[model samples]
Target: MPELKLAIDAMGGDNGPSVVIEALINSLKQDTTTQFVVVGDEAILSSLFSQFELSDHPQVTLVHAEQVVEMTDKPGATMRQKPQSSMRVALDMHAHGEVDGVVSGGNTGALMAQAYFILKPIPGVLRPALMAALPNMTGGRSYLLDLGANPSCDSETLFQFGVMGSVAARVLESDKNVSVALLNMGEEELKGNDEVRNAAQLLGQSEHVNYIGFIEGNHLFSGRADVIVCDGFVGNIALKSCEGLATLIIDELKASLTSHWLYSWFFKFLQKRTKKSWQRLKPDHYNGASLIGLRGVVVKSHGSANATAFESAISHAIKEASHRLPEKIQDRVESVLLEQH
Candidate 1:
């Protein structure tokens, strides 16, 4: 396989370069073929290098960046003012073809802003959507899109999300016949608002996507749809809610299991089973959200992600880069739009 070069914004996450470096160390253990350009403060990254004993690693290169984009900064204004920030520099490397992809555990809004400004949208795409691979029932995964990237979307934008999402599902799941659905209150044809209903009509008419009408919130993890399309506002709430609920359930189960002694062996077995199940539902396992419809690959990791979660985000970027996902999405979008015209 060809080696992939990725740029990392090491200073963006909550734990700063430490978590990024730790994740890099773990990632390198699994795949030594991948090279990384670590962008952050040279002094801090150097300290981490010594701490992690990767001072002479051939696959890692340090690029000094003077500024860091804070999580609280305004996306549009910050991207304009902080051109040389770690996050922006990493994205610049990918935009300039120095790296195959860029990964950053940074402010989602800033990341999206910078990506759109630098890479631009793929041909014929109106806007890029943030997409994440969520674990679904039947032990499969579903692709959910526009996770807080564009909070308000029109009918045409929603239709475009369906197109982009279908292409994404095909690439990620390796299933040409991917099922696409609009997230709404009910499955009735006239249930949702005008935007959703209009988008659903377009999706149903298009041969490019396997439109499955409407899917309720409960159906998100049911494996009934391979791709779920919605505006960023709804998608963000749904995703965060799922993450919170999953964490709460796991914690409650652990507490209950430890509080009992009569069923100690049974509790142990249940604990193990619950742990496995929770692992499947964990947010960290699905850490990367792709900013699809761009000319280059840019993956957004959760700002508070730990080493394991950060590594998962890196892996997601690698997969998207390896497959030339943006180009595929562009092609699909163009095809769908041409049919509409």
Candidate 2:
């Protein structure tokens, strides 16, 4: 049977070992063949496992760590001071080839910093990007790249994001003729600041990218573009805005539904249908973001992820590991780099 070894940061995330433990148990239940190395305080994990009556999970292995990296602490100091941190331990396991892939709900900056420094770029990859698949009402999803990697990038960077995002879309969604668009203030050729204009020009010249011109913020869910490329600063803002808006909308709807006596009775049935329809909109539904262009697959999950979210992240990491996506991405990106030589 094909096997996948996953290193999970058990001490990370807001819920700590409870969520991580549950996620591991849940994932193992679905795929008994998969194995996990829980990198965190072994005592805490063991206690949680026993408390949850999950001692029968044979696929799990415990790896000990003495410290936990708090979300607020400086990543550099934590990396040096606490070498046994769950995040560091998990990354180290992947770096040493002890594990096929790693999943973490730890600090984003810290995880990225450690992974990039330790693993480095995949030979010729200039920069690594973060890509996420967003839910759309049109039954098709859209991909956003550089969601929080590079804060400010140039035209070449944006063009590269196009290629990277396009490749991911093809692999994840099977969209061959994927349309790439630059996130801009307007759809016109002459629009926005100099950065947008420059990126537009560069994307226009890319033969590898099916450049579909500029995309405004509102166009994110329009299903008109397959891949949207922008610097991390802009992309992060957009991602956060979407998340905040979705949360606000969901909360308001729930509040309004249960506000009255008659509505409260009907709310239960309505909620079931509403939740089913809005399942894809939840951030936790797709918690893992692929760290593209790396030599190895690194999946970043939300720091506040719960058990279900962590489970989803692990599944995602396993998929990347099974396919050797990082290797394929490296080969493709290196080929492009070599052509420039």
Candidate 3:
């Protein structure tokens, strides 16, 4: 296998370059075949390298970027004003083929805008969708797409999401027989608005996709479908709701367990089991979300991610780059579009 080189937006996250550098060092320890091009303030990054005694490391390189895109910056304005920002520089490297992929814990809107402008969408793809992996009830995972990318989408766009998501599931899950479904209010064919109903018809007609029809929100984690398709509006809400619910459950459990010692031994046992279960479902473990439909690979890390979370994001990018996920998605999209015509 060839060495996988990734461009990192070192100053994009809340913790700044320190977290990015630490994550890179940790990732390098586990994967020697990977190389990094850290984009940020050269002086600061260099000082950190010296402090970590990694100044002589063969696999890491530093690239200087003049500006940093803040999380609150407007996407369009940032793109125009901060062309030399670390986020833009990392993306530019991917566009120029200097890196296999780009990983960033930056403003989602700005990153998505820069990616679309620089890399552009794959041929026949109308728009790129943000795809994330969610742990399912079956101890496996499912791919959900269009998560806050485009708040609104047409029937054709939803169909395209299904194709891209199915390809993603195949690569990430290593399962060719992936079943797909559209997120709707009800499971009936006629439940959702015209957009979803139309998309369902298209998916059902797709010979290449195993379209399983409509799935309600309650079935998202049931593992009933490998791919769940929705517009960004609904997908984003669903994603955030799940995160909020998880936090509430964990906090409540902790309070309840420590409140009384009447069942101390049993509470301790339950706590241990609960902790293990929560670890498996931690957002940090699945921190990277792919901007699918782009010409090259791009993974978005959570803006507030820590070292462990950022490392997981980097690993996700490496996997997608190594697997050539964009190309796979492109092929699937073209085939599906051809069938539609």
The top-ranked prediction according to lDDT is: 3
RMSD values, in order shown = 2.0, 2.1, 1.8
Candidate 1 error regions (>4 Å): 251-269
Lowest-sum lDDT 10-residue window in model 2: 332-341
Model 2 residue 175 lDDT score: 42
lDDT of 2 at 324: 78
Q: What is the TM-score of each candidate against the true structure?
A: 0.93, 0.92, 0.95
> Which one wins by lDDT: 2 or 3?
3
Give the winner by TM-score. 3
- Clash pairs for candidate 1: none
Superposed Cα RMSD, model 2? 2.1
Instruction: Give lDDT for model 2.
Output: 0.81
Task: Put the candidates in TM-score order, highest first.
Answer: 3, 1, 2
